[model samples]
Target: MGNSYEDECRRSLAEEQAKSLAGTNNWEHVDRERVHQDWDVLYREITPFLDGGSLPGDQQIQEFVRRHFDIVCRFYTPSREAYVGMSLFYAEDEAMRAFHDSYHPGLVEFLGAAIKVFAEQGSGFAPSAGEASA
Candidate 1:
């Protein structure tokens, strides 16, 4: 099958959403090397919002993971069949938790809303409350 414009649009939207959440147009600066070397910095920079508890951080994580992981699943068919993978790594790592906690409320809410818009306009993959249960 061929890739669709909808797919391209979804990816573009996701990248934009992630960039806005990170408060930088420089997300390209984030990669495995950066994630490994500066995770603490990234987490510290993004946590307060995740911890605010006004909006659900887990749900935001779920949607982000789902949209990104779906692209992975299209290539690696056996990785899993879920919209969002287990989020097991996020659960097992303290730094990941800290990263989630660091998100500013405004940013987190914006991300959540953007994810909702992406789902509605593109994928229709609304994150169930249970998906964020972890």
Candidate 2:
């Protein structure tokens, strides 16, 4: 009845991707097209088990999110690093807060990973020292 390690990982990945996409500063408009493409890629890669045309169950959804997170973090080759960071950062937007919050226990790990990736990739950004500690 609780979230599994895998589930948590998936959720974390999604959350991280979302936060990174959102970025630290508010922008007039986020590139929805790019976001959708990135999400599509993640969705296709994870192939989350959906039920009744929706995510399987809270537990299953969590697992799917975790798996996607791992893939986003681990799949980036040196050449694709920039794109991966950009895609993950684009995922973090106000519109997605609800989607991220839907999962209980939250996907903090995903958010953390995204931040780490963004920083490491030199996405022309950095979380504040406090945020970095977070």
Write one digit per residue (lDDT tens) for candidate 2, span 1-134: 13363344345445544565566343225555765567656555333233223333344454554444444444321112333343343455555544543442233334434333443444322232124433
Q: TM-score of the candidate numbered 1?
A: 0.27
Give stretches of model 2 more than 4 Å off. 1-48, 51-57, 75-130
Q: After superposition, which runs of candidate 1 have C-alpha atoms over 4 Å from their true positions?
A: 1-31, 37-41, 57-83, 92-134
The models' CA-based lDDT, in order, is 0.40, 0.41
lDDT of 1 by residue, 44-89 (tens): 5444545565343355554553544444333232112122222322
TM-score of each: 0.27, 0.25
Model 1 is weakest, by summed lDDT over 10 consecutive residues, at: 77-86
How many residue pairs clash in all the candidates, one count each?
A: 8, 19
Best candidate according to TM-score: 1
| Model 2 lowest lDDT segment of ten | 75-84
lDDT of 2 at 35: 56
